[model samples]
Target: MLRACAAAFIVAAGAGAALAQSQPPITMAINQSPWLNSFVAMVDEYEKETGNKVELDVTPFGGLLEKIRNSVRGAQGAYDIVNVNSLWLSEIYSGGFLAPLGDVQAGYGLPEGVLTYGDTTNWDAEAGTFAGGGALMGVPVNGNVQVLYYNTDIYAKLGLQPPKTWDELLANAQAIQNEGEAYGFVPRAARDSIVYNFTPYLFSHDAAFFRIAGSGKADVVVNSPEALKALETYVKLATESGPPGPGNIAQGELIQLLATGKGAQAIAVIAAWGQLEDPNASRVVGKIDAALLPAGPAGTVASSAGHWVAGIPRNVPPEKQKAALAFLDWFAAKERQVDYVRAGGVPVRGDITGADLGDDAAFRFIGAYSQNAQHAVMGLPFAQAAEASDAMALSLNRAVIGEMTPAQALNQAAADLAGVLERNGFAVTKLPDL
Candidate 1:
């Protein structure tokens, strides 16, 4: 494994060089994320190497979409590059906001590891199917995936090994709870948290939200028996072993709980690992370790990927566009990628899974994280993905708070999801009865 950007270095070689020399500062619309500091460090390195100034229009995660949308919709888009998440990538692509990655670049072919990202990196614009069948879109700067994190000190003190199955995880949680030394677990349940936090549970149970049937059809499997079981395990893990008033816990709170040494175990994104090692914000520094998510009743270890992609807007000026694309090439180079990881960024290169973590033993998490990400499933890839997620998010929150039984909540969510697909012009037929 190597630490570096592996995107195909494309052609036109030196065609864009002269134009990029005098290009305006490349503007990028990106969100504030756990890996942002590392990203910025890479950006700084790019500037120092290429003399290309970059303006990062950083905003909250939720606000990023609107900002990118406002820019991409205009005649001449505001930003040169837009950072998109797998969850809503279809929205940007389907709207024709992004130009194909090869349109304005001069780089080598994509690295084998980069192609492992599949639809997150490529798509079929004509067929409207996301199978990496069409042109490449962008590089996956963040190879984010869900993994179980445990406090090594706590696990050793209690003589507990990292759980390999959901049942074992719950048992460990209960054991930690009985000890009263720290909270057994922490779950993010507030406002859109359940979808991301609980996806590994759903996937481990062999459940999926939707299965694309064809270019214009899909089957909704969100309320299946497997999903119900997954949901049950999710709620049980949170309420029985998690901290008090678990319903209000969100991403920040979950990280805070673990970083402050108040939590023993939980599942979180690989990108979030940076916070655990930050000396100023984390008391659990050097005590935390990560592993693949435990297997579910179906004996599957699965997780959700929320990798972030970088794309150039079609409407941006040629010089700015070239500069932005070149920045991507510079940022992804092997040397730069190693530096990126060393600065606290997750590597998107599958080849890097074997890289030595230097003196930091904590970087062992990268192996687990990268291995898990290679097989991780995405949240959704349809243009109406946000609406679909909202439909389920409501039900998930209700179900988590015990306002509705798992059956009732998922049933309602499935029904609403069907309507969303139908309205979005997808012929949705299959429905699961809970």
Candidate 2:
């Protein structure tokens, strides 16, 4: 009887050891969107490969930010991973709520070039480093570029080719409006959409919200003549052919109008085209195509590139930190990046350009856009960027709705931006030469 009891105890101990080898379940929080679904699918594949279970917590964008801020402040570390925009890096890093990933990147054999973009040793190092150089804070998950999406059918009907410059775009807009079948162009003129859709124009004109005269210093430049010109053009386009209250339209409504063939073109994120192509979600599946945004007086076109950034929160257990890095290394691998592209997550790897994918029209369009992304511009850095962006958006909406002249709106926006920077303790300086 004693021998039999000992045998049972030994077996139970072995079972417990096996269970311990399995990864503890982890939960990730995300803003509710179609992208979240794609991420969940990738996590499911990761779970199967590593014997780990991951739970996803979906919340509205606004709510997600508040919850994350609260969780980090309380040192709760409720989430194992979080998705952050580049602009929020400063605020979050300043709070010492994120763990550095430099060692983790080294462990994973991440290439020098990949790290360079996010490395402090390179240009804009101050922007990439957190809290005065503690650790690498985040891994870029996906690439998003703003592009000009058009309905192929609509273009064919009007005998229109892609606009190569701002003048051409204006001409096309007028022609499309004259046809009286659909609006010529649509952009997010209202809410935050205007800021997101319009910044590329500013950059294309060699204008910036803040000009970096030195390595780590940037001066506000929103009131420059070039910026004023860009703003005026944006307002002109919306007033001439866009729908009523273009400044008030939601992104969803704007997209819906474009997808239903009520609009001819939109300056939109490339990922949005995927949403437009999903037969289950879009009615314009076969008719849409995209290209880079048109050039301006600066003789260059600009697109905005945004990526999903993953980072470890500070105060996580060391072992868990190791695990998180392991996961990120595996997730950011080139093979996995390709898989992510196949699975509808945009690829950020340099080697995995859109052209390298299959030769379908969708891939062709995405590839062209991705190739041009190397020159795309990023918005103002995260510190107080959101507030500044909101002010810009508000001013843009006023212009779009004819509530203010372009000059009046832009001047006010520049003043408002200056106030935001000042309130945040950043010094205000002259606008850039442009």
Candidate 3:
């Protein structure tokens, strides 16, 4: 009996030694965002619990793609783990930079349906798959979708109800302008951040930058009638109801405009909910609430998902890869995610399934936000997402600034997309007559 106990102790010690010896310090590449301070806040605790060192490099959103591009192209081992935006998954996975999550399934526990934004049948598609391909690439770490935020007092004073359609939204904007209160609406329109905000508008009009996946052949569809109409609506609204020079405004600036009451309403990202409701950070606190984005001519209110995900780089050593996956699993767990949200991080999980949000102003829209996430489209899932986005931005900016009409701008964008697709060896099945 004494010998048996001694044998068990030896086996346990051996396992511990194996773990300590194999895993190296993890280096994670993340986007620079204030909300992610929650991750930084918990690093010490994570290291203490795991007995592993972690190094975090937060790159600016504009520069992150280039930084990640260099890492993948060089296989430089610069990052063992990377926090990637949804649009970058296609390029990153195709570059062979990410290790399949399924390969490391034993390293983490997969959450059930109740904890994921989508159900079991679709969670894998939404959270795991890269570019609609059947490979699990990463675990979601953030929730970002567009929602409508309006100043309740302003709406009441203007006798405006929350907009339920784009026409109504336009009318509301017109009302604010005619009444001489403030900018009617605000949203990011700068080149660097335009695509993220523009996608919801594109979807609302049933226009897509590319038919990136599915049967037959993929194609660029940016010059369709729907796309032209959407572009016209966006440019007109910005010129008439939004602040002058919207082409220079981005997410942060738009948020400031709304929070300070310079804007009466906004179609903005969900990450700013905490700031919008905080009395210390906003002048409109207790006077603002969020609603689903207004529907388009098609009677659909589609949005694009902009969440960040944690993935392991394929260039890392096996042990370090294991450690990276372990970190992702721990960091994205239900308890940690909830704590992160409470600490100003964006909520990504559906774990609040049965928990009561109960009129807490900070949490009132979470359930609605989650529902929006399910219907959200992920943009232009192609190996050249960045390149395609740059092309679209140039044309979109021209239209917004009145340097070109919407039709001219969209025609140029469609041509650019066609060139990109053909250069990447994909056949363009269809294109607008332009």
Residue 373 in candidate 2 has what lDDT? 62
| Candidate 2 Cα errors over 4 Å, as ranges | 1-26, 105-135, 212-218, 353-365, 431-434
Clashes in predicted model 2: 1
Would you estimate the TM-scores of all the predictions?
0.86, 0.82, 0.81
What are the clashing pairs of model 2?
Answer: 87-382
Q: Residues 65-126, candidate 3, lDDT per residue (tens digit)?
A: 88887775674578887877777766676666777777765533455422232221122233
* Global Cα lDDT for candidate 1: 0.78
The model with the greater TM-score, 2 or 3, is 2
Tell me the deviation in Å of residue 230 in model 3: 1.9
Query: Per-model C-alpha lDDT, please?
Result: 0.78, 0.67, 0.71
Q: Estimate candidate 2's alpha-carbon lDDT, on a 0 to 1 scale.
A: 0.67
By TM-score, who's the top model here? 1
After TM-score superposition, what is the CA distance of residue 207 in candidate 1 from its true location, in Å? 1.5
Off by over 4 Å in 1: 1-25, 32-34, 51-55, 59-63, 105-109, 115-118, 126-129, 297-299, 317-322, 353-355
**Clashes per candidate, residues 3 or more apart or on different chains:** 14, 1, 0
For model 2, how does the per-residue alpha-carbon lDDT over 1-434 read when each residue is reduced to its tens digit? 00001010001122212323456665565667656555556665666556665666778877877767776666568776776655565567666677767653453334322422233211224543222243557666666677788888878998999888887888888889899888898867877678877887788888877765544445777778888888877887888978887888767877888878798888877667787887877778878887767888968777765555677776566656666666665666665665666666676665666545666655656554564465566566545667888877787788888888877777777778778877876666755332
How close is each model in CA RMSD to the real structure?
5.2, 8.1, 7.7
Candidate 3 matches the true fold with a TM-score of 0.81
